[model samples]
Target: MPGAPFLRGDRVDLRTVTPEDYDFLLEHGNDPAIRHGAPAPTPVTREDLANFVEDDDESVQFLACHGETPVGFVFLFDVDPWRDHAELGCWIAPNEQGEGYATEAAALCLDHAFGDRGLHKVVARVFEHNDASMAVLDKLGFQQEGRLREQDYVRGQHHDTLLFGLLAEEFEV
Candidate 1:
């Protein structure tokens, strides 16, 4: 069973990641549609997932759940308290994509990031081909701050990576 939510939204609640979620995460992380956008598209193992869940002190990771069902994952990683900023990342299950879940979940995390954590800014990196994620970031008021040319080699081709940023004062909802 999932634990109590650390952050709640109208349709989604961001809860602490637990050991029980490994299988769900493993399946999604290894999915071709999902892995292709990842920085390293290498297969993830149980050990890798475990390490990610347990060893990342600089991240605030959560399972995005609807009611009692997990639908996606969201996190604020590479948190730099000294700099008052962090990188936001999220992924929805393929079956649950295009339903606004990613946007809702990410908004919830941004609330925590800027409100609770008192962050000045939050940034995200999206692959050039990830139109969905780019749309999500756009809806969340993230501006395209920069772009790296051919930054990631996905599948058999190189893709540009877009950098987006949102300031705490500029966030709404």
Candidate 2:
């Protein structure tokens, strides 16, 4: 969405998430698809997001919009200035899944994190069962660094996580 001019694309629009995005955040947070990614209650109130976006955040968040409509959110975090490390994470609206939007948006974010932000490495840890996300990260050249056993407990069951990473020098595109 951000690659082209005016932050526009067929699948999404990349914009900053504002305090006004509370409604969208709440709706998406309760979404089953998003819950599968990283389950948490979306705060309906403005204060809910204030804790994250208030100051000069080392991390960055972007709201993914489709046309004039808001659809999802993406973020880059775990920014370590000393070691120059960061992590890439994203989530698409439930209705927008399996449409390649995530891949495209992620690529842009990764580029900015490593190329523009001067980060040396970007990492991601996805649930082992999330094949689609795993594929997207793989296509982006993120290698499987390790497998974390029982790293998460979600929906009343324990699941393993796959730690994936991509280095700045390793990016081909």
Model 2, residue 96: what's the lDDT?
A: 80
**RMSD, every candidate, angstroms:** 1.0, 3.2
**Candidate lDDT (C-alpha), each:** 0.91, 0.76
**TM-score, per-candidate, Cα-based:** 0.96, 0.86
Question: Against the true structure, candidate 2 has what lDDT?
Answer: 0.76
lDDT of 1 by residue, 47-96 (tens): 98888789988888899999999998899999999999999999999999
Question: Model 1: what TM-score?
Answer: 0.96
